[model samples]
Target chain A: MIEVLNPTAGPATGKIMMAERTGTLDGLRLGVIWNGRPYGDRVINSVIDLLRQKYSFESVTFRKKPFIGNVAPASIRDEIVESCDAVITGIGD
Target chain B: MVDRLTADRISVENLDAAMELYFERGWTDGLPVVPPTEMKVMEFLDYAGLEPGRPLGDVPERDRVITAEHLAINAVMAGCKKEYMPVLVASVEAICHPDFRFNHMATLGSAWPMLIVNGPMGRDLGFNSGMYLLSSAGNRPSSTVARAISLLFWNCTESRPDGIQRGQFGNPGRGHYCIAENEETSWDPLHVMLGFDREQSTVTAVSTYPGPYQVYCQRTANPELMLDSMADAISTYDFYRGTYILLVPPHFAELFIQRGWSKHDVRRYLMDNCKRSVADLKRRGLWGLHSSEYDGFAGVAQAVQPGDEDRYAYVFKPHEYDRIMFDDTTLLRRSDIYVVVGGGNAGPRLCFLAPYGVSTDPMTVAVHPV
Candidate 1:
């Protein structure tokens, strides 16, 4: 009779994967993407107002996404990448 | 001094040596454990009918991979019988499912998975489905199984006391949280009512962060009125809109049975009736609405759009009490309401709400007797 050997007794073989980040947020142009909802629009407006009052900005632009839980549209994404220093997206209810 | 084993066959004399090896390898839950002798480990591997090196699953976020051999080692340490290996394996599988989000669960500052057992295996494993079931009053298999799984998680995964698993106000359930769905007394078995085959045994592992909240109601006969009370309970400040509910005891079911009300009926009633006006939620200061950089206060002020008849709908509306009240219940079908019967017979009481910080739909794991 052929004896079946269990192979699972070996030492554990796996590693933890971590998320990656690009660069720091310094004087980059900030692009804000808002879901075309009342809450998102409102939050964007508040943020813009604060930036205007507090810091000097190189350039700032705004784009609106169609749905709350969805990614920004291609047009909006392109606009953000081209125009803004760093992108800020909001999922306001 | 430890006795030497012949042909990898460890004797009882090597027990202390094995425990010391485990301690050196950082494989313990603080509590002392019985050493996994080579013979005992072989027994567990045989019981699971698995190869000693079969990969259980990876703890993705932690970067550590788990295998059957690791689980068997932890099981022996947890004082589990070799016959319980199948249940342990199944629980590990359920937790590792992508939907279960095991990585998020380990780091999140809440108690680990609360194992809920259903089906015939629950009774066969000596789990408590009746009175004082949630408490540790009875010497049932529920406690032992729950403890065994928790130990496995701790040992295999990189979860240590103050390391990664940080539960601020840990619950007693942390010690071991395994309870059965009282199928005999219940009008519906938990798994069957949750869209599983009534005959087949299934384990669901839900990752809830805040633990469960209890909702008790008595003295209301009208189904609508009773559901309304449930709505109020679910709409509290702590209650989020999308969390699930676990119904306990037969009293709630008795009400539905008496009124010819299906789970769907209760869900619809709660959804339609449990809601307060969007204005009410804001007035009560329950909205944790955050303002963005662009909007400023002006944007936030504008976000409160005018509702019908010039009313403003709050950004965060109270969750449809109906959805939170019944799982498996669809908004349209009302009958999709998920109801599991358990606990001792008493007044109509239900436990609803999911863990805080994590997503709704906690993973539920059932430990079976092999």
Candidate 2:
């Protein structure tokens, strides 16, 4: 029997897993991070507005990464973590 | 006995069944992969003196760590000879270099990583350095090496055409594009210019979007006239571009050499001449006015300048706007103009344009032969 070797490097994993869902979208502040894409701000803001209409949110914090192509700087990431209960990072193009 | 492999094993009835299974699992690049049996993989790792668990590189954004075994398996599947393992290993290391920006190549642009081989091993390994450098004509090592890189990107990064690979019009070069410098010609090889010794065999990996754009200058023997032709070829690009490579063949290099100009001189000339005005750049839709309408445009805009919203294009003084805009601003400073000599040594002078933003840096890694 011929045995084929696996080529993939395996799936991605991170030390810090995403916060578990609290099963409630009420009174939680949401963070919106724009990745410098064109519609990223508009699309994310629209999502926030939709969320606002459905649930009562304490506040919505907006943060944009300083540059594109590379990962967001630590300061920006840290600010998001410290200020908001949950975050939606816009990560396209 | 060979080192025991730790990769998950799947017993197949035969080679044909293995190929079918790999296809079904989406492991292949829509092409048949040679069954990467345990024997072949072990042999491949042994040829390169690489441990199966050796970490070649990691794509942190994608959360994937590519190992020696991962590349060896794909290299074997790509039909590479056992001896070709070293080159593949080096290439994997090169692309995963923080500067190489392998992740960005998988984005919406038609960018594919092009490999440029240098030194004696290029000829020793039988890679084509002359005419049709991009084609797979009777050259197994060159073509298979390139194909193996694509498979690595696919299997490791998970950037498939239907997935993360968002090229608007992905070119065929995505599969394979490898060429060597024509050493026979009396011109400076690319590695030498990059400060590497001429004798060392190195593989320089770069991201070229939409393959190479060949610029032809047949009648013009004058250096100024010839460079003007080349400048005109790249001037019309609306997006702010950077890190373009000019593959100047022997004949063209001869003209510059006769004029007592070195590769530095050619880069200086192009950096001075190849330019577009700020008004022209703005007209190319580089301004943020309506950039968000397209998904691809949005990403490029964001990556161009992440947090700064107003200053979308390169900031030029009012007077500077009228003057030509070099991607690196004051030219010849950054790794902007990369010159390599190749082709039939005659015919229309060909140059390749590899565009990367200010955020990414290109790299050259020496292929350590066993």
Which residue pairs of candidate 2 clash?
A36-B302, A66-B307, A67-B306, A68-B303, B108-B166
* Candidate 1 deviant stretches above 4 angstroms: A1-93, B1-26, B106-111, B273-276, B283-285, B288-337, B356-370
lDDT of 2 by residue, A1-93 (tens): 688877877767574366788678788877788876555788888888888889988888897764556677799888878887877775674
Which regions of candidate 2 fall more than 4 Å away from where they truly are? A14-16, A22-26, A54-59, B1-3, B278-335
All candidates: TM-score of chain A = 0.62, 0.79
The candidate that achieves the highest TM-score relative to the unseen native structure? 2
> Across residues B8-121, which tens digit of lDDT does each residue of candidate 1 receive?
232333556656555665666556677666567678877877776687766655556667777776677677777767667877878775545464433334645656667767
Model 2 lDDT, residue B229, Cα? 80
Looking at model 1, residue B325 earns an lDDT score of 26
Worst ten-residue run, lDDT, model 1 chain B?
Answer: B326-335
Clashes of 2: 5
